[model samples]
Target: MKLFHYIVTNRLCHILSTIVIAILISTTCHAAKTKYIWQSSDQFVALEQQDSPSTNTVAPNDHPATVTSETISAMLSSLEIRATDSDKPEPLFTAVAVQSIAPQILQGLRQASPTEDVTFAVIGLHNTSYGFVKSHKVTTGRVYYQAGRLNILIGQAQKEVNDRDDRRLAPFTPGSRHKTSEGDWQLLPQPGQKGFSLQRKDWAAFSTEWQPPAAVQSVSPQQSIPAGLIAPARQPSPADRLIVLKELKEKGLISEEEYRSKRQEILNLL
Candidate 1:
């Protein structure tokens, strides 16, 4: 899995700047990082949710199938979506197709479960989109959806700035999983949406059915370690310690006095 360096998200009123003097980690220049995506058919139920069907249950956008949705239309079926902007009552989720992310998605989809309704959401400091050259040398950027079952390219209804990622996953720390108050990762408008605001009680309720971690194997009380094999309490084994002492002395890790002390301990064990 390849990792692309990503930047922090700056608010519009605020500028989310990268680390002091950063580099643009091109995805093609480097391979896409292995990212964990959380998906759910019921994500909308947790939204300010006004009854929305998932991409699988909804009609295909135009006609092509997808795993993720950038625009509302891409994620929803034929239902009338209220425009976040009343001036554009056309649809809330408009599909802004960035063809660059498509081929990779198609390729990943081939590797996922054929029957699963896969959705991928991430909140992290990673590039959500990348640039690619078209046949005619056209430069383009698109949202990259890489997950099991459906590696389809989708995006926010109208966002086209591929170099800039959705602020969605920006705040997530690298190499850690995030849990909402709901205890589920998928309860967002998109995956890892802004301002995780689930109530503490809701998080508790969600965790009620969450099973406790499987019990680690219990060691038998008879599995007592032999005291003779315990060696010295604070040191390594005599044979091993002797080896270390010799190496350290040879490698100049210890003075002669320290070497003598260790050497004597090794003999004392015998």
Candidate 2:
């Protein structure tokens, strides 16, 4: 009877050990399978985002729509614009007819075939009016609206240069007079406008119309240079000058030739 009890206890212990080992192996395999699934899904999602176009974040005020005074106003406001001139009143946005914008500029902005004649709009903000070209129901380009008429500033220097309420409308940057089969749709500075030219070149005039960078006050060269050339009153030392020159080059303020020339001049002075 003692021998029979001992044999039964050993068989029971062996059975329990086998059950525990099977459970451990099964759990580890499941955990590894789950980890692999998660890794593969994360990689697929990351690849999709990389291939997609940059998403345009919706502004607090943005409401996507076609051309209209009310809609254009909302669109301009959506840009979160600040006034260029403090004295200027809030602008009243207006929709422009499809025919008003230059054909080349119009065509360039709109690539959708079966291109319904797109109606652009002029929005007044930042002290001047900007042409709003629509693409996929969003304002794409801030053009010079209606040549020079809508661009009048609160205190314009050239008040004499004016456009009639009724006039042929063109873009701020119109291509040169030279004939091209598709029309000179090339961007600004391509043909380059002369300051003296009678034609309204608002492209050059208001190139910085949209959110002109904050004004930076600069010291005049004469003010910085001492009255006497023998010794500079405010001139930086050679080491300081080299540092400044390096900074200017890094910031793209000076050309390579100018940098080399100025550096040599400073060295010679030392």
Error of 2 at 168 (Å): 12
Question: What tens digits encode model 1's per-residue C-alpha lDDT throughout 119-209?
Answer: 2222111112242321111111112222211112211222222334432332111111122222111212222323222222111111112
State the TM-score for model 1. 0.21
Instruction: List the global CA lDDT of all models.
Output: 0.28, 0.30
Runs in model 1 deviating more than 4 A are 1-18, 22-82, 91-104, 112-155, 160-270
Which lDDT tens digits does candidate 2 get at residues 1-270? 999999999999999988867666765553343211111101100000001124532112111212233322332332221233333333222122111223422232232122111222221112223324321111112222222211111111111112332112211111211212132111122224222121222222222123322224555677664466444344545655665576567668899999999999989986
Where is the poorest 10-residue window by lDDT in model 1? 42-51
Report model 2's TM-score to 2 decimal places: 0.16
List the candidates' TM-scores in order. 0.21, 0.16
Worst 10 residues of 2 by lDDT: 41-50
